[model samples]
Target: MEINMFFLVLLILIPTFVLIIQNKRPKSNLPPTPPSLPIIGHLHLLKEPLHKTLHNMSHNFGPVMLLRFGVRKVVVLTSPSAVEECFTKTNDVVVANRPQLMQAKHLNYNYTTMGAAPYGTLWHALRRVAATELLSATRLDTTTNLREHEVKLMCRQIYNDSSHKVNFKSWFRDLTNNITTMAIIGKRYYGDEINMGDLKEAVEFREMMEEFFIVMHTETLGDFIPVIRWIGFDGVEKKMIDLI
Candidate 1:
């Protein structure tokens, strides 16, 4: 009877202790949040057509509401004025840092790429290089003929194939890929009539690019939840690491 009473008292005390600790903690100044579950927060409310769902939520929570996606806190700003405020001189530097995503770490050489890098000395240097060399007006004008030639080639190919059904989407994708690769590497990797000598290399490069796009865009659960990463519960994280 004494043992049974002791167990009953322990259970009662545990909840009371938790409640007391919670009541004593200081409340945060976060904006109004929708009701959330204990571990998952507001994840369950994220339905398909995410933009529409967020828009609807903004109606109730206001433009500057905060949300917890797994463990990460997100601030949703719907109004144009609120968005402008974040990019102003005062707030721009504060908000310029990109979230250190798993893909950026593995594929982008640990956020060293200009697109992935945080706004810092390295980014400034990269911007200077791009301005004077890669994207300068003189450099662009030099490449004008290359762009025109590629467009003419594509148009001729399309015209020749007018009798058959043409996939404009595939053609457009090829056109853009060829133009980008030519600009960056001095050779086009996509489309027919590629040099037979470089056919094997081109095929390999295309495969690599396709895989890169797939891995870059795919979401990993580890990005959102720390425990998922620590416990090795997210297989997508492993795939990302392997791809890199």
Candidate 2:
């Protein structure tokens, strides 16, 4: 009974001692942060419509606020001027690297894609190739005829369907998809031009794209908290691997 009481006291006192030490630690250089709970940090403070909540928090904490999303420390900049300064010519290079998310690692070829790559020689090469080969003035000029053809096709479709109710949203979406696909791959998959063989492939591609967006927006707890991922508590890593 005495040992049991001692253990209970130790358990209570240990966490209290740690909290006291943490509170006393120096943080003179860091931005203002709201009081956060242990383990979860500021996660409990967030609500639906996350952007609005953050904007509201800025009112009390100032434009530049430090927050912890689970175990990850995030510096929120609410003011446009503050954001612009953070991304200026001199600061852009320093902040070019993005957070290494789990989805990015598995789905983005181990972060080798231009958008996911860490700022380095590989990123520079990717940017150069995109500028010189994919998005050059000459490459854009070559797509002028393709854009006109797609627009004319869309107009004809609208005219043909004038007798019936037209879904402009869907038509515009298709037009945009067709234009982009034709520009990139010389094949358009979203319109009447698609054949039976291509139709199956196109359907699969569309489904894949929908799934990709769903995965991208998914809020996995493992992403912000390392132990959750290490213990496979969320199964997020498995889903990402399966997506790939």
- Best candidate, TM-score-wise? 1
lDDT of 2 by residue, 1-244 (tens): 9978976886587557658877898867999999997656799999989999999999999999999887688999999999999899989887789888888888889999998999999999999999999899999899999999999999999999999999999899999999898887777788676878788889887788778878877878888866578779888788778877
Evaluated at residue 232, the lDDT of candidate 1 is: 84
Supply every candidate's count of residue pairs whose N, Cα or C atoms clash at under 3 angstroms. 0, 0
Model 2: residues >4 Å from true position, as ranges?
1-28, 163-165
All candidates: TM-score: 0.83, 0.82
RMSD of each: 6.2, 4.8
Backbone clashes in model 1, listed as residue pairs = none
Off by over 4 Å in 1: 1-25
Per-candidate Cα lDDT values, in order, are 0.84, 0.86
Pairs in clash, predicted candidate 2: none
The superposed Cα distance between candidate 2 and the true structure at residue 89, in angstroms, equals 3.1
